[model samples]
Structures are given as structure tokens and as C-alpha cells.
Target: MVNKAWRIIPRPLLETVLNNHAQHHRVPQPLILHGPRGVGKTTLILERLLGEWNKGPHLTGYIDFAESIEDHHPQFNKSFPWASWSNCPPPALSSCRSKLEHTLESMVEKGVKLGTISSHQIFTTLNKWHGLNTALRRVIQSNNAASKSAVVGKASPSVLWDRAVFALSARCNAQEIDGVLGLSEKWKGLSIEEASYFREAFLALRLAKEVITVQHGWRANAIAHLNRTGGFSRSLAHSCTDWPCLLLELLSQAAEIDHFQPKLVINNIDVLRNATLNDDSSVSASMYHDSLIWRMIALGANERCLPIILVTSDSYYSYQAYLDFGFTDIFISREMFGWTPQEAKMHMVTDYFSPSEWTVIAEVLGPIPRHLFELYALKQSDYYQKVMGDKGSTFEDIVDAYLAYLQITVVNPAMDNALELLKKFAVDARNGKISKDKLRFGAPWRHPPKTDDPTQCMEWAKLQLMDFVQCLVNTEFGDWEETLHSFFALFILLRLAVVGMIS
Candidate 1:
């Protein structure tokens, strides 16, 4: 896919999220970015992640839960498919590192910036294991020349080699057991039999990426040691120890913004809510029971008091999980909404979008930024492009093209029902039953069961109908009296017209 410039039209919701935690300079808990699906929640955070990668001194551990990666996130090319979700749960070292590798790649782009180290991981004994990413030679050759120019005076491969060993010597914080909390046995898994030259080898791989990303033809002999065993993961799982420490110093030493700097950003966290652990019959439910996200909250996220943001689509926000985990205090909920009239008008003034088309879109699709983006993408597409350039430029003309794009672009089973409803509305609008004052989206169901005397089943059905109507009236159209009166009048008019036609 071709790259598009990320033009994030700022809204009140966007400003609130960007500043909410940063103001305190300490994230007492994760900032929960909550919103309806496809409302540009992912796009908003990703803007801050990649577009502003170096602007903020944050070390993000982004985990996308969708089993497979989509084009929604910024593309780093073919070297990144492995960085997508692997079968491991978030708590698993491999799972977390997949996300951290994203962070690693971003760091490579900006050139690794490290602050003074106050904390380090130490292991009494280190062992040898075979795990390194192969195919570095080809990857390095493919990166652009400008990328090479960016790392003019950055660390040499040899110095990075030493830093890798230092990271390993600090034990990279694998759960070690001092035997006090009964973690002694658990700690041994990380300490015993580590790859002998794993640190050197892994740094060689990273240095290779840096060279490819920023130094061009600067080759390293260490690249030969890179292989595709468990090598990539084994080295990566060790860095989780360094990330929080590395982040702490970076955040601490940074120039204060809102008098504090944020250290982390967690994206697409539905994996923490969904993935299964081991051979458990229940998948998401089980993962939800002992969440790594919750564990992180209880540990450094809360204790260190660093500003952090956790973003997820409302489709997977799961309020039940929130209640189950008692996460009331772990996150400050920020619910995103559609653009206001002024914001929508403001966005239209930009160079990329035309005011005439957007004014109609806001009226039709209700100022949803995501829908606007989708419509923009549709118009830019080759199939729709010809019509845009060659056809009439009227509002109706644009609406017609939008309808055609909608029909084919997002084809789904649910749209059949929606389209049928739309047909009924079109008939009503044509008959003058719908006006600006009473814009009914879908007509009420016409048929009712014939009954002289009410049976128990009929009574039950009546109660169900009232409940459903109440929900619709309350949520869909807010004016209770006017909404019901208008609907009742429209129904009576329809019934009278039907009898007159029969006569």
C-alpha cells in the first residue's frame, strides 16, 4: 500500500487524550482511550506513535490483538511481518517482544536515543542459546539512502555490541527468585542456560538494522552470526527488562512537558482481553482472568507514576471485563465522539479536502471523521476517480457516487437489511411523511398478529414491543413526546391511506 500523509484534524477529544496524563507528568494508571469502532481511535494514537515518533520521548509497547496485522498501522515494509501478533498471549515474553520489536524498529528510525542509566539487569551466570534473525544482508540493502544519512554520528556497531552485553549482564529482569516470594524456581528459567554470545549476536542484528536504516553500506562481521533460530525472540524477551528502565531514565531526564514526560503508549490492547493461555478451553475469558495489563498496572505503571496511554476500540472495550478485574482506578476513561459542527467545518478548510463535498458529507454521515476518511479514500480510488473527474459536480452527484462506493466497498450481510430499510425511507420521503422535523430512519414494522382477546403470549409480546420502542425512542431520537407523537400520527395516516386505496 502507498503511504498517505497523516493529517490528524484535532478535536476536543484528541486534545484531552494528548494532555490528560501529560499534565500530571506521572501516569497513576493507564489512560483508557475508549470510543466506538471505526471512529479513528487507532489513527489518532498511531499519529502520535509513528508520525511524532521522535517528538515525544516515549517507548511504546504496541500490541495489536487482531491475530494478523492489517494495513491500518504505518508500514515498515517486509522486515515487519514477524512483528505482527504471534500465537503467544501478552504475558508471554515472546508476545510482548513482538510489540517491543515495533518499538525497536521505531527507535532505529529515529536513531536509538538513550538517557543516563540508573538501573541495570544483572545475571550471576549466563548460558548459550541459538536465537537470532537471519536475512539481514538483504534487508540492509533495501533501505533508502536518506535513512542511512540520518545516523551520521550514532553509535558504532562495536559500541552497540558492548551495550548489548551490559543489558544481558543486568539479567534483563527475567522473573528471578531470591527465594523470598517463592519465585526462586520461576526466576531460574531466565537465568540458566542463556545464549553465551546472545547479547553480542542480538546487537549485531540491531546494528545491522541501524546500518540498513541509517548507515547504508557500513557492514559488520557480527551480521554473519545472525541466524533464524529462536534467536530473535530469545534476545528480545531479554529487552523487556531494559525498556522500563530505559524509559524511566529517558522520561526523567527529558525536558518537562506539562512539567512531565510520558514514558509509554500501549495500542490495540484487545489481545490482553482476548488471547488464550496454554490449552485452556476458554480463550478470552481465561486471559481476562489474569491480565498482563492489570499486572503492569499494579507494578511499574502505578508505582513509577509515569504518564501512559492505552488505546482500544469500543467494540472490544468489554465493560464486563472492567468490572471483573476491578480496574476502576487503573485507567481514566476518555470516550471519543464525532466531530462537532465547527470542527467539521474547520477540517474542511484544509488543502486536501473540498468544502462543497464535505458540507454534504457532514449532513449525510453526521460529521464522523472516519466516514470522511473512507469517503476520501473511495473518491481517490481508480474505480471512483473517473466518476469524480468526469461526472457532474452537484450534491446529488456526489451523494450518488457515495452510494455506489458504499454498495461495493463494504459489502456485508448486514447491509442487506440496512438497504431494505433505506428503500422504505426513500418511499416515505417521496410521500412527504418525513421532513426535517421528523426524520424517521426506518419505518415501524407493519404487521401485527390478529387477536380479539389478549392471550398470555400476546401480553408478553406487547410488553416486549413497548420495551424495544422505549429503548429506540430514548437513544435514537431524544424527544420522547414529539418522537412518539410524530410516529403515531404517521402510522394513522398510513392506515387511513391503505383503507382508502382498498375502497
Candidate 2:
């Protein structure tokens, strides 16, 4: 038999949403993909990445805030596949650093009315700076006119910037520098401020060029640091926000470069939540609040005509809230596909265990997942045979074994509380006389009513009592209290009926 364990179920609704994202490049608003654990939210996002959205100018990022990246020792073999920060090449890191430095330098030099700068512009400026730095280093190294010492110390900023362009040309054997520099190249001979502004613009262009090729698709880069004393400050959250903003800027810059608005697909946000929320308890409250920040980013991206797709597992927001956030579409779980209780039972029984074992297994496990059902099923047989083998396979023997397990493992510690509650419920039922209304409404009863024959009420009450007792075999005191209250009410009605018949 094929191991059906690995079978992939197609979630059509998720696929439809992803398809819309890919084709329309529109952001899905308030798409709450909620389900019980093990229902494959993460799996769906991965599939979307590899399948339809593979070719789009989309940058996907995953952040599991629940995992602590800071704890990973620096000396740990950096080449390990799952080594959080080690997967990227040195060139990529160097490129990122250069871009960030250049962008900051450009921003500072242009003094481009800081508030007027779009987040994308800031990101582009940074990336371009890095590319400029790389090109400058290469060009200076290759030029006979510029000695290493002079290049490092006395080289003009414009010259340093040009070297980057030359280096880029030599590496790619293409005039990419011109395309990136755009109108900035025309202001090379202007005033110092003008020159600086143009250079900043040039740096931004170079950064945008590199980002399209160098960055991995759909990978969330989260920076997590723990204070030596073990708490997170507001500074940490701000630092985390910086990278995502840069990324969003990159997407915006891509649209500028291509002159066609680019679409962004934001998925696997839970991964980020898990990463940021992992281990460090101080930032947990902020984790929930971060969704609002993300919503703002989404709206900002949308306003710039960049299509944004945000996929999340949270279902707390109303449709109107999502609409207000500028989400054009919504995909929810109930509106999608999910397993019903009966379907879950059937799937577990047929797919998990043999038919011969299912009945006994279901009796112990009820209708849940296969793993849970199997756990209880295995316990029932092994426990009964080991503890009561000589007694044989009788109903009483099974009940006795179950009760013994309950006493030893489940209710033993809470038995006193359970008995007290049960007694209290019994007294309450005795106090209530047997009127049909009292029988129907009385405390915590589960017995079915006897419409015609009042005498049958006693049998119904006894059966309910037995069920209640069975439920208590391995249950908590609180559960026992509730069950007893119901049975007690029924018993009182039975007593009242008995008195009425005699009168």
C-alpha cells in the first residue's frame, strides 16, 4: 500500500487568491487564513512562491519571530544549511552593506528634505551607494592613474563614485552605470551640493540594479538581538522595521526603473511573528501590534501603485477594517476548504489504522486526528492485557482497567474535588421535585426524557448516571462537577415523579 501520509491536498481557495495576486498584482486585503494546527498555511505559501509567482518582480520574505537568531553562536559552522544568516554568499553581504552605507551617505548629503523622501527612495539611495562603492573599489584597483594610497585618502567623491561605475562596467562588460545614473550623470560638473545630490541619485540607481539580481526571492531578513541582561527595547523593534521598509522601497524602485508598477506578494507573516516573539517575552505585546504597522506598509505600497499581497494566519479583523486598510480582496478559511468532524473521523479511520482496530480505537480516542486516536487505541489494548489478562475480554474487565488507569493517572490527584462536586450535584437533584419542567430544566442533566411512561424516567436517569461516571474515570474535577450537576437534576425529577405517583 502506498504511504498516503505524504499526499498533497490542493487548497483551491488559496490557489485562487495566489493566482489573482500573480495575474493582477493586486494586494489581497484582510485575507485571514485560519484553521486548526497542522492545516498547512505555511505549505500553501511555499507552493505559491514556487509555482505562479516565481517570475514576478516580487520579493518574498519569511520571518519566524518565535526563533531566536541571536542564540546561534558565531563560531557555529556558518555553512550549515539551516544556519540562519550563513546561507547567503559573502558578495551578497558586501553588496548589502555597501548599498546601506551609500544610501545613508546620499541621504545625508542631498539633505533632500527628509520628510519628502518616500521610503522607496531611501531604499534605492542606499542600494545604489553600495553598488557605487563596489564599482569605485574595482575601478580604483584597476586604474594606473590612481595609486592605492591616493585613492583611499585624496580621491574626490565624484572620482570615487565614477570608479564604481567603471568597476561595474568591467565586471558585467555592459554600460549598466548609465542606466542607473540617469540624469545624475549630467550634473557631474555642478556645485558641491548639486554634485552630491546627483551622486546620491546615481548610488540609488546602482543599488536598485543589484537588488533585482542579488536578493533571494521571498525571504524575510529579521535582525534580532538580545540585551546582555535579557530584554528587548523599543530600539529593537525600530531596527527590525528598517529592513522591511528598505525591501518595500526596493519594490517601489523597481517600478521606477521599469516604468511599470511592480506587484508585491507578502506571505508567511506568521514566520516573522514566530521569529520576533520567540523566547524573548518582553516583545510579545508588540508582536500583535506589529500587524497594524504591516497594514500601514501595505497601504503605503498600494498608494504608490505597487500591488501588495499580504497573507496572514490571524482572523481577528473585520472585513471593514481590511477594506479600510486598502485590501482589494479577502480569502478566509470557511470560505475556502476545511475538514468537518465527520470527515475528520472518516479520514482518520480509513487512512490511519486497520479496520479491525478502528472500532476499539474510536471508542477510546473519539473522533479526532489519527495520531491522537492511535495513542489512546494503543493504550487501551496494551494496558488492559498487561493489567487484567486473566480476567478475559469482558465489558466489566475493560471498565475496571479503564477506571484503574483513570484513578492512577487522571483523576487520582483531583478525586477528592470530583467526589465533593458529584455529591453536591446529587443533593441539588434531590431538592428539586419531578415536574416535567423541572426534569427538563434542572441542573446539568444529560438523560433523554420519557414522554409517555414516567416509570422509564428512572432507567433513563440511571443510564445518564452511568455515562457521567464513565466520563469521570479519567477526567478533571471541573468536568466531574459539571457532569454530576446534570445527573443530580435528573435524579431529583425522578424522585418527585415517584412521590406524585404514590399520592
Candidate 3:
């Protein structure tokens, strides 16, 4: 794992755009960072922007949906291995979707408490407001006495949710009372609005606590199904949606009292679009669920005056959420298609490589930052340098070595079915079904026409090559015309035509 920092080529211009909106007194429209995959959307948001924002009076919450999905199933990297190579059903797809809203709530809670107070303090205050925790006072005091050093640790939102839920449930059970609702009589001095806010926020946190607690159960069920049946099950139940409004409203009110700007950065929202593709329902219906989420968040952003920044590598823009969610009217879009050739050359000139060496490497890898950064690691390896020794110019050998590496790491990992598709397309090219002009132009793979059939759509949604086609589509030849000029593509295509590849 290369440090992503080495791969980052700073874009001060984009940072200024982000800062302009972030620093605004009034809530600016939601900011969207859009690009194809591997063009550094997450790195820029996490490393460059949020780091600086967190150090200021601004409170920030960041979540990468893709990372969360992958976290639940370690067997699948970002490559989404099951969809590419296995017959087993994708694990934790439902779990990830079920937890989405609550996960956002957790992030909101994180922002609200950022740098201002500890989670213990907030929970204590919240308990006082709800007036249901007289039984826990001794327990809290004893715990505090038992672990003076440990008190500073484990104050994350999920932990806070878990503790709050436990205290409330135990108190309610012992008294044979309803949950938060039964505590209405305790709202002695509070105004009606204040009482309502406390009640709703507590209920929302309780529901979020349940969703977080059940995640492990979902994973266990997924693994059990995979072991016994050799297939995946998406039978996990979903959480209710009303909790997000309560969560957001509470966060907004807290920010007003604290007098700090709050920003939320959500990365890889396209995972929602991808997860929904596995749904058994119609595509439109699947999209409708995600659409509702957009409307909720968009409206919340306005009402709460909470600035939100969205980062996605979804090239199709999740079927244009801008138009469908009316985001065009309320969002500012920033596109990162990697750097220009001249910009790459300038950025590549550093301590790692000389002028000529870096120039050749940049030209070979194009403007793609990931590949260029990879070369830094390759150059540092003694074994790699030994392999390339005195064969040719360092440039030529390095380029050849990098291409060979890609063949093994990228092209070779494609599922047998995906390789067959590529070979069949190649044969069609040889037989004139695919014209030379079309091949030269790098035309999109013509998938089967979408019908009303769910089975057909499911078949179409399985990406046979995992990240292989995605890498090309997103990073190198965003337009196929560039494919002909990309030596990398030509090299991979030539290698895949061999019968040994499919076998």
C-alpha cells in the first residue's frame, strides 16, 4: 500500500473553490466533486481539504461509502471481487444499504461534537435532558472511578449511541415503562419545542444504535449463507428514514449554539447506485429509493444551513442526480479529470526522478496520478532495477516492466467470462463484425439492450472484469478515441487475444 500522499498532485485552484464555499457566512449550495474513478477524488477530499478544515473552527464529518461496504467484507477489496469472479452472492450489500442513513446520522453527530466536548459530556447532558437515568448515576460514578485513564478513550458516535441505548433500555425495563415517550412528564421546566427536540433526538439516536449493533449479525448471516448454501442472501431488514431529519435538526441547533461552521463530506455516493443494481426490483424503482435520499439531504442542507460536500467518481452521475434530484439548482459541481500533460510533467519533476526519467514515465502513464505514483515505489525496489539493468534506456525498460506488471495485476485478474468476452470481441474484429474504425475509435462495449426483465438487468450489472474495465473507462480512455493512442490499451489487447489467456 503506497502512501496516497505521494500520489497527490496539489490543485490549489480547486482548493480555493472549496474554501470559498466553506468560508461563506450563509450556507452555499451543496458542493459536488465529480470525476471518473482513480482520479484522486477521495485523496483530495480526505487529505487536502478535510485535514485543513478540521484544524479550524469548522467541524467536519467524513465518510467513504465504498470503504464502509468493503469494511464489512474484507474478502472484497474495492474491486468488488464477488461481482467479478464468484458465483456466490455479494455479501453485506443489504447490510451496507440498511445502515446508510444511520451512518450519516453518526457522521452528523461527529460534526456536532467536534473539538467542542467529549461524547461522555454530551451523553451526560442528553441524559439529564431526557430525565430517565437516575438508576445509572451510581453505575456511572463507579465506572468513572474504576477507569480514570480509560475515560479519555472510545468516545465515538457509535460508542455513544451504544451506551445511551443500553442505559435507556435498562431503566425502561426495570420500571416497566415505555422508552423515551414515557419520560414526557419529566419535561417539567422545558418549553414545548425544547422537550420535543430532546425526545426526537433521543429516539433517533436509539434507532441508530440498533442499526449499528445489528451490523455484525448481518455479516454473520452473510458468511453462514455463503458457507452452507454457496450463495449470497440480501434478506437483511432496512431501518426507518425519519431518524435522519431528527439527527440533522439536532446537529444544526448544536452548531448554532457553538457558533462553528459545520461541513459534511461524503465520498463515493455512487456505491448507493451500485448496491441498488443488485436489487430484484425494476431499475426505476431501485433508483427511486436513492432519489428520495437525495431529496431528503438536499432539503436538509438548506433548512439546516449545513454545508455539504459530495465526492463521486460516478461518470454517469448516477443517472444525472443533478436533474432528477434538482441538484442543478442547488449544487456546485467540480470535475477532476486528472491533470493535463504539461501539468503532469511539472508535477513529476521532484527528488524521485530526473528530468528525462520523469518525463518518459509521465508520457507512458499519461496524466493518471495513481500509475505515476506507483512508478516511485517501483523505482525504489532493488529487484525491479536489477531486472531492468542494462537492457535498454531506463525509460524503455521501466515502461515495459510497468506494462508487464499491469498484465499480471490488472488484465490477468479478469474473470474467465470477461476474458471470453474480450476474445470474442477480438475475433469479431478479425472477422469484420467490429470494423477497424470502430476498434480504433475505442467505442463503448455494446451491452445487451435493457428490457423489463430483472434477470437480464442482473446479468448486465455483474462487471466481469471488476476494476479492469473501470480503470480504463475511468482513467485512461474516458473517450475511446484515446484508446488507439494509448499504448497501454493496445498492449493489453494484444496480450489478451492469445488463447492461453482464456484457458
TM-score of each: 0.48, 0.38, 0.55
Worst window of 10 by summed lDDT in candidate 1: 121-130
Question: How does residue 233 of candidate 3 score in lDDT?
Answer: 31
- lDDT pick, better of 1 and 3: 3
Q: Give the TM-score comparing model 3 with the true structure, all chains together.
A: 0.55
Q: What TM-score does structure 1 among the candidates reach?
A: 0.48
Candidate 1 off by > 4 Å: 1-6, 23-25, 48-67, 71-97, 100-262, 276-290, 300-302, 315-318, 349-359, 380-385, 388-397, 404-503
> In candidate 3, what are the lDDT values of residues 1-503, reduced to their tens digit?
12234545578998888888776523635677876444566667767888777655566767555554543333364442212112123223454444555555655545432323233434543443232332233233333454334434546444544454454444434232223244445557567675444443444355434443443333454444443554423232122222343344445545543356666677655554455333322222134345435544555565544667777655445236667666465567788767777787777665556787766765566666656666777777775658657566455686788778766755455444454554454455545675555444332543332243544433433432433455555654444454334232233333332111221
In model 3, where do residues sit more than 4 Å from their true spots? 1-8, 24-28, 69-91, 97-239, 276-292, 297-305, 326-330, 390-393, 411-503
For all predictions, the C-alpha RMSD in Å is 18.3, 17.7, 13.2
Across residues 314-426, which tens digit of lDDT does each residue of candidate 2 receive? 33232433464345443322333334445555665556544544566445533323233324353446564565466455434554554465446433333333333334443
- Candidate 1 lDDT over 210-304, as tens digits, reads 42232212222222222222123222222223333333333433324432244456665654444433321112323332434554455445355
